[model samples]
Target: MNYEIIINSIASIGVILSVIFLAYQIKKNTQASRANYYDSLNKTNMEFLRQLVENRELGELLEKATSNWDNLNEDDKRTSNYLFIQLFRHWENMFYQHKLSVLDKQLWTNHLNTMIGYFHHDGTQEWWLKRKMAFAKDFRDFLEKTEKPKQIYPTIKDLTIKNK
Candidate 1:
């Protein structure tokens, strides 16, 4: 009778330990899934922004040129300004979501400053405005050159290997 009681106690403890281990595994898997979801979202956002910058058509440039700050028709000005602000907001969100470093932030700030200078210039007619637009195009090229490809898989695998 004593032997049977000891065996039953040990079996119960083993079952409880297994249950605890499974729960911990499930929790870890859940956290990893959440992180991957956020990372996918971040990558999608960056790709969308890059595509927009790359695919700006000539018609869009003409539209921007027509809608001058000084002489914009009210509705034209409103829409242009709204779009500009939204782009700026997206840029800022990307910067934070991607965990950009101080150097990256400085580079982005310089790009913004260049645009601001064009916006504030008093003599920005079609000729100078076109130059400014070219400047923007060049900046977009620079960003494309600088952006690192997403390497989440290899990075995570290396980390796991290191731990083991």
Candidate 2:
């Protein structure tokens, strides 16, 4: 009977240790998933930026769309509008994921704030005005409720000067 008791106690300890190790593993997996989510988001955003840098025509269309929509020719307008829709679709996915708590709050908010900053432009604002209703209602509601930036994000030079 004593031997049985000792055996049971050892088994109990083992079970407890297993539970603790599983808990640690669960936590680690959760963290890794979060890291991966943010990494994917970064990659998507970087690709968009890279496209703007590498394609001169795309870069010019984006500039014209943001600064003066009227300056665009018919082809430019079609291209600009297409690009804006694609960009917004990406952001809408981010918004939906963030709403579902799939995204880390701080990371999502950082990206959201930068996107909202871009929406401050007249051309983007006009596009949103025309097409806001076409998006998912929940995503549209979130965008409508969030505060947009009053001014465009500053250039790197501006940031450098301000930090000095």
Candidate 3:
């Protein structure tokens, strides 16, 4: 009878130990998952900030190029056109990747139209300056109109905040 009682006690202790170990493993896995999720969210937010700065810089460069139309040498003009085209393509790539807002796409389209308008009037350098100013105004309007989402979703916020 004593032998049976010892065996039962040993079995009960073993079961209790196994349950404790399993619970600990589950807790560790949960923590690791939370860490990974937060890390990923941080990386994404960083990328978005970086991309926004880059896009804004590109927009400024295009605006500068448009302003220099009167003084630009033929080669400089060609280079400017090439750079603007490349910027447009990059903007399109970002849009397709879902990294840019829809309003951004419309803003870029307005710039493209303005560029087309410049070339469309090939004969007259006289109207170039006026046309450029008009385009700039259109671009400013676009900037004023496009609004960013104030706060990301709670899931995104939860992931962004560091685990305690």
Best by lDDT: 2
TM-score of each: 0.36, 0.79, 0.36
Clashing pairs in 3: none
Better of 1 and 2 by TM-score: 2
lDDT of 2 by residue, 16-55 (tens): 9999999999999988987887788788889988998999
Which parts of model 3 have CA positions greater than 4 angstroms off?
57-164
Model 2, which residues run further than 4 Å from truth?
A: 68-71, 154-164
Query: Between prediction 1 and prediction 2, which has the larger lDDT?
Result: 2
User: What is candidate 3's lDDT per residue for 1-164, written digit by digit as tens?
Assistant: 99999999999999999999999999999777656644654465466446537887543444445444556566656655665444434434433433333234554465445334433332223223343343335443443344432432222224455453
Predictions in order: lDDT = 0.49, 0.80, 0.48
Provide the global lDDT of candidate 3 against the true structure.
0.48
- lDDT score of residue 73 within candidate 3: 63
lDDT of 1 by residue, 75-96 (tens): 6555555444444345444445
User: Over the full model, what C-alpha lDDT does candidate 1 score relative to the true structure?
Assistant: 0.49
Model 3 TM: 0.36
Q: What is the lDDT of residue 111 in candidate 3?
A: 40
| lDDT ranking, best first | 2, 1, 3
Better of 1 and 3 by lDDT: 1
lDDT of 1 at 82: 49
